[model samples]
Target: MKIKHLTRALILGALLSITGAMSSCEKQTQTQAQAQDGQYVKKGEGALSNVMLATIQSAAYTPTLPTKATIIESPSNVLSPRTENDNQNQINAAITNLSNSGGGTVLLGSGIFRIKSPIILKSNVRLKGGGQDVSIIKRDESWTNVEGRGMLESGGYIEDLTISDLSIDGNRPESYRMSNQFPLFGIEITIDNGGTTRNNRVYITNVKIVNTGMGCHIKHTNNVILKGNYIVGNGTLASSTHSLPTFFHNVYLRSIDKAWVYGTNYFKDSPGGNGLNITHLTNLTVEDNIMTGNNFRGIRLGGSSSIILVRGNTVSSNTDFGIGLAYDETGQPQNFSIIDNTVNNNDNNGIYIPNNTKNGEVQGNSLSGNSPLNIKKGTNLTNVSCQAN
Candidate 1:
């Protein structure tokens, strides 16, 4: 009886030990899981949570965020003899000084500066005016021969500046008379300087380019925004050279990325000359713009790839089709979208989509006041959506 009792005691002890071990292992597993859950929650909140919380707390107590505007210094009053213009030296000096000080705004007081040469803008330098009409940069006809006299040619990084309320007259009155001389119109604003990887930006707003050649010539640029400007090409020149005409649609934009032309007006006549002509570009957006009195189509695209969005624009009184999509030398427009545009009173078809064009979407545009709703030339056209008259 004593031996059996001992055996029973031993068995009971072993069972108790096993249960204790299992319980301890389970407890350890649960603790490790709890620790991992806590770590995940902390990591999910991110490292900036403390800073964001502090900022919110401060904002709740403060009335407004502190802010201030910096006013740039002006150069000494000096005049340039070549252009017979006041503030030419001052303007150059001010721009240089602004560039040296990282970046700042260079204000042009109310006056006309007869610029004989093109002004080079530095990185972060803003050449601004009091208003578009008040501050004018008139072109000196004699100085047009200078190497770089094409109004404002920007190669540096420019941002947050207004180059508007100014006038650029190419002053070539003699070349306007020849009908065959279609290339004499000079460029108002030329960008990129044909440099590689020059990411320059410009805001040309509330200005007028009258009786001059190409309004704003953008070449080899990226992220250019042309807005709220009036470009009228109605001048008669005596002899036409290789230069584009005053109203010639020579807004040359080649090899550009992510460009936008919005809320502006262009009047011109020709195949390459229109309100907006994009070539060899990717990711273009032409929105809320008005192209009237154009001799050719309003918007023309050639040699462009990727999705080009044309929305909320007005194209009227054009002698040719409202929109023309022609393939490049190789005959391919990879993808395009034309939506919600108001095209009316055009002499030819409202929208011309050729046979070589592929992967285009045309929808929700008003074409009743014009000709046929959609015109397709080739077999490769796909994903086209339109409401006919």
Candidate 2:
């Protein structure tokens, strides 16, 4: 009778253990689903990167719109001397004519074109140049505000625009430093002041932008592509009364959607500058870029940004965290994937997720020689199997 009783107790204990284990696993799976929120629902293991890469490669290979028959121009071909007035007039003429004719390319030949005011881009007009080393757009010191916007501004509510293969020297020389109006960026794609939605379907590539308050600033834009550009903020040239490092970022994007920032290089000589500053964005992919030697973070997603993929980038040698996720009082960063990157040599954490930021994956990254990954807040955190080397 004693032996039979002992056997019954053992059987009951084993059954309970199995049931408990099953319950625990179910809870874990629920948590993962909640955290991921169906972002990677159809993505198989080890294939997420491949899928995203294919999308990028295809996009780069086959542009959705027609980009043939570039209209080429040059100082040598246009009126001679190609002073600030000459170059600006020629380029503007080409763009205006093309836009009026339903859009085309305006290619600039190898030369240094001094621009004293904004080069406005109209709908369906592309501005191409000789290689960055050969074609230069040097900002004239005498020039200040282009309708209170950037050196190269865009037409309001424009679409199918391309700016590629050039160098823009902001020339923020000591004489040109005005802290109040400091961010004299090389390119600024802005929505019309009173318009809610403008500036859509823009592409920028193979450009070298330097010595500016900000290299490139895009606001309220959609379907943007910034690829193979070298954006550097050499802060030594300008003196800001407000702060030591006058420059803010190499590239700044806000209220942008369906954008891909790939194969670009962003760096800064001084501290307190960001390689890329993103705010209130959606459906964005930032991959295969080099962001290093900046004052602040390499990449920052602030405000109410969602559906982001950051992968295969080398972000290092920064003063602050390598990759940072930020949120405002009413916003929470969500639906992000941080994978397969080599982020190292930063002064702060490799990846930072503060309170109010959740629903993300940090996996398959080689993060070393920096502050460890920090998950400051939020529950049901889905780390998704990271192997830190």
| Candidate whose lDDT is highest | 2
**Per-residue C-alpha lDDT of model 2 across residues 169-266, encoded as one tens digit per residue:** 88776544334355577788887665366567888889888877777888887788888888886332235565334446778888877778887555
lDDT of the candidates, in the order given: 0.55, 0.67
Q: lDDT per residue, candidate 1, 238-318, as tens digits? A: 334545333346355656666766775454543334666667767777778877666666777777545677777888767
TM-scores for all candidates?
A: 0.67, 0.73
> What lDDT does model 1 reach?
0.55
TM-score of 2: 0.73
Best by TM-score: 2
